[model samples]
Target chain A: MEITPEKLRWIYTTMYRIRRFEEVLLEQTALGKSMGVAHTSDGEEAGPTGICAHLTDDDWIASTHRGHGHCIAKGVDTAGMMAEIFGKHTGLCKGKGGSMHIADFTKGMLGANGIVGAGIPLGVGAALSAKLKGDGSVGVSFFGDGATGEGTIHESMNLASVWKLPAIFVCENNHYAESTPVEYAVSVADIADRAASYSMPGVVVDGMDVFAVYDAAGEAIARARAGEGPTFLELKTYRYHGHFHADDPHTYRLPEEEELWKARDPLPNFERRVTEQDLMDDVEMERIRNEIDQEIQDAVKFAEESPLPPLEELYTDVYVNYSNPPQGLR
Target chain B: MTLDLRPDPLGPGFDVPGSEIRYREAFNRTLGDELRRDPDVFVMGEDVAGGAGREHLGIIDSWGGAFAATKGLIQEFGAERVRDTPISEAGFVGAAIGAALTGTRPVVDLMYFDFITVAWDQLLSNAAKNRYMFGGQGKIPITLFARSGVAAGYSAQHSQNFYSMVAHIPGLKCVAPSDAYTCRGLLAAAIRDDDPVIVCNHKKLINMSSFVPDESYTIELGKGRYLRRGSDVTLVGMSYTTEVCRLAAERLAEQGINAEVVDMLSLSPIDEDIVLESVTKTNRIVIVDEDTPRCNMASDIAALVADKAFDSLDAPVKRVTGPHTPVPYSKPLEDAFIPSPEDVVATTVALLGA
Candidate 1:
């Protein structure tokens, strides 16, 4: 479980990249350049950065509405994603699916679902496909603490365990489900504990620490690849922003809790660990930060300059046969 | 194509031409043939094997599914290819979509079409939307099998026809086979096609059989069949209602009125040219559907005729449909709720009079 210098650099860059990407989205929303509402992964970067670091393009991951970080970590082009958010023709879904439904099948990143807990069963399905194909590839599901309340998660977990499918369920417990506090919504003390009912391994980790999540996710993924069945990992983390761009977190969040979480911000925590151990110096960290910032700026520019999708595009991607009437509007 | 005016041979044990095969048997044979033909094809549903994980006291497949639609598939394909699942529709249905997205072409049984409501999100949102939502990078080649319409006494909950609800969705293809011959071909086409298709087999017609080929062959989707042809008036029917239309046509012949019966096989991408041509030739039309009247195929077909065949129509389109309420348990009430051959005859007569 020893962390390599290369892994540290990747985790640092990924976490910062997620932070910067969300910041640009926030700016776009403020300027009214974005299409619909968006949920950002400002402080929850470590979870995706750690878990996806162990995955290859052969593996698959299903994500939630707040899924930009997962898309980036899974290798979905940021330029295409930003263009989608801006409702341009060059978007991943050709502007048909905005932020909430962004997807890139080539990268094995299933579409981000608008419905909570919907991705769990889809991930289990991909795992079933991989198992049937006799490949060692696995499928991962990234969902929020709120999704733990959905029946789909429980059904998917039991099915995966019974079939011994290679599926990993990662619960990002960000302490909130939209405006509702997780404490009032979830009946379980630890969401991972539910895994035992399905006869699967369950682990809890510090979502703010990239190293901890990396080690835990790696073990679970390895177990899945070896045909040991599914694993549930509950990562405790927090979202620095409101539930969505237009939402007011202060209405439901207490000032003291927000302050306590900010002190343990995932980006700053990873930067401190890397710098303190001399795995990476301040100069190197600054360079990575500047590079990500410039990248985000370029993506915004690309999205802004891109043309609006043509009206005929409305009927284009609905099916492979753009002319077949069964799946077409015409 | 000449209309086969021969009386339905399905009776007193569900007989048919050549070798009499029941609707369920045709379905079973098709699954076995497809599994043997393709390596990536599989069948999964509740009670599909009935003995998936545990031994069934020397019996391999006990239930064979709710309607015996998947009987004997477990023995042929084994447990991995023919899997029995818990009563979790959303999970398995979504999983089927996932499997189709990756490599497998899965045929999933939703058990009862009524139960699709539980897994509606998966079918409507994911399965139907994936191909288009992913910018043509993904395709869901999954065939969903479900029994719609009333069986003798299954009552309101288990006996509703909701294929119209699925037909309204953009990326979904819906088919309701009237008999055994159409069922095998349509089901095979649904499995081999690169899009998600829902095959709604009427529960009442499961025992009835027609002349179906013993081998695998696919009938083209989105094509309507002219069950019987005449020039006096066009009678439109779908699913089990097609039988009623044929019987009504015979009764009309006794009255010296010719009725051309059209079976609306593929509901969504309806064969508009056939329908328009039939109406244009006959100059009179009557639509018979077992589903509740509003927002159903009857209304959709009516709109199509009104829009495209308005000049050819000598009379306004007439429709005989089921009542808006759920299928009743009482025999008399249920009989009244469903449209009968007599209703079709009366509707066609009224259209001619108008």
Candidate 2:
């Protein structure tokens, strides 16, 4: 894939932004600024940024609960997202959805789902709509290896393949699903091999390497847009934190495994690759990181200063024109 | 019998001068008309266009949907709009919700109301809460249809009135169309609605014919109308139970008793005003439901009246509903399971002390 100067900046910047954004958001959540649990996607930055790099606002992506990285990568406004997670009036979901349900329809980011495997079919439906409209837009579903056990994913993959819909199923295998290991749950050794059952091409990529994710995602996305049908991508990655804000990985996973994955962090890997290839200098990379660091601080301040949603807002936005409130809500 | 109403549903620019048709026909016609009206509207579900994608073998649309709700729709709208899906209930419903979220309107026929449990998570989590959770980013304008209530010996699973379950959620809109007229009006209203609306088509009422306007129109969502006017006692009904209330009212009239009937077209954003108004004037009510007792629609309406209309009620609010038991397969047992017109009359008589 051709990486222009501007494209290269965006790729690096997005990955860095995702990492910093999560680091800062975790701090805020720890401070009790957020109303609900915040599922930060720190170590899994490359999985979303690389895939989203090939997508535009017209294309759609459905995300899992660990979705903050996907939201940033999809170009959702961080201030609105921060405020939303902070439970402020100016938040993306008007303080209603908080962290788990942040979505911008205009941006084609089809919300971070609260349910485990629920977003799978939703993305496939968008692909179906795209096919019917004869539009070139492709829909992507970002899920974890744990979600493979869900019936919706399997059903959706078959539907997309039968209709030859433009959809990319990106399975980020983050080693663990909450407290359970993938080995104990999933029948197959590789999630990608299951794609064969649905008559679709499946590719496995290194989730820690931005280039690998970008390369695989670009080819899969191109194939979808060409009407060649859906592709299943299993991205081998890890999460720096627990399943949720309060979870502790010490109970389920070992420190050695954590150290092995963290050693190949996407941000450091990208910096080394670019410097060695003479694609970008260390100063330029540092400048981008500094800029993102400030952006994260500004987002935190905006969220802190924003007001909480009013009492009346509790009853609003349930339905577009439901003037006659449900008897109980009223 | 020529239907007569004090307010006159056919009065002054209302009720089109057209033909009488079965509730099923109205259902089938409205879908085709809606598909024609909007390019974005599409239908999907098991057997919605049953034999689709089999044009090579000279077979087409063998099932046309479960109750034949989309019987002629495929021929008019084509197979592209009329989608026949696998029996994966959760998958298709999620896809429908996704399609609705991104602009198009998807009308999904889930065959039986009993099967709603299979896809309950999708309906409850995604379709219902999409807009609310996203803080008004988009609307889930998906209309779901499922056959409800007891037809015969379909047994426990087939015959169920789970409207109260959907209505229990704050985000979804639930409706039960009573006859051809309501089936036509309510189905159209549900299609155009911006929120997720579940239209419960009762199995017993599908073949029943009533005067239906040929012209396209929508019955206002969350509104109920008086089927018959009387000052004595109010008989509240939903779906097929409304027919039971009407029949009981007719019988009561012959015995010098005046019973009013209220057909609740919508259940979620319930027509609280109409129910309150009827109860306040008549000072008595008998709510009829076909679902199993305990946290069902009958109990809900009873609670609503007791909470709001306590001062106006002269007699205790009684309920005539299916007993707390699964519908039996045997003829005699199934007959006993469903609340009949006689059941309504007996309950109303006891409530009135007459």
- For model 1, what is the alpha-carbon lDDT of residue B264? 79
Work out the TM-score per prediction.
Answer: 0.96, 0.98
* Model 1 CAPRI quality: medium
Residue B242 lDDT in candidate 1: 91
All candidates: CA RMSD (Å): 3.2, 2.1
Provide per-model DockQ scores: 0.61, 0.81
Q: Which pairs of residues collide in model 1?
A: none
lDDT of 2 by residue, B1-354 (tens): 122232545465454477889999999988988898989999999988878999789888897888788886788778879998888899889888888888899999989999999999999999889888898889989999999988778898999899899998878999998999888888888999999999999999999998887787778888888989889899999999999999999988887779989988799878888899999989999999988889988888899899999999998888888888888899898889888999988887777775
The lDDT per prediction is 0.87, 0.89
Candidate 2 local Cα displacement, residue A54, angstroms: 0.7
True contacts kept of 1: 0.60
**C-alpha-based local distance difference test score of model 2:** 0.89
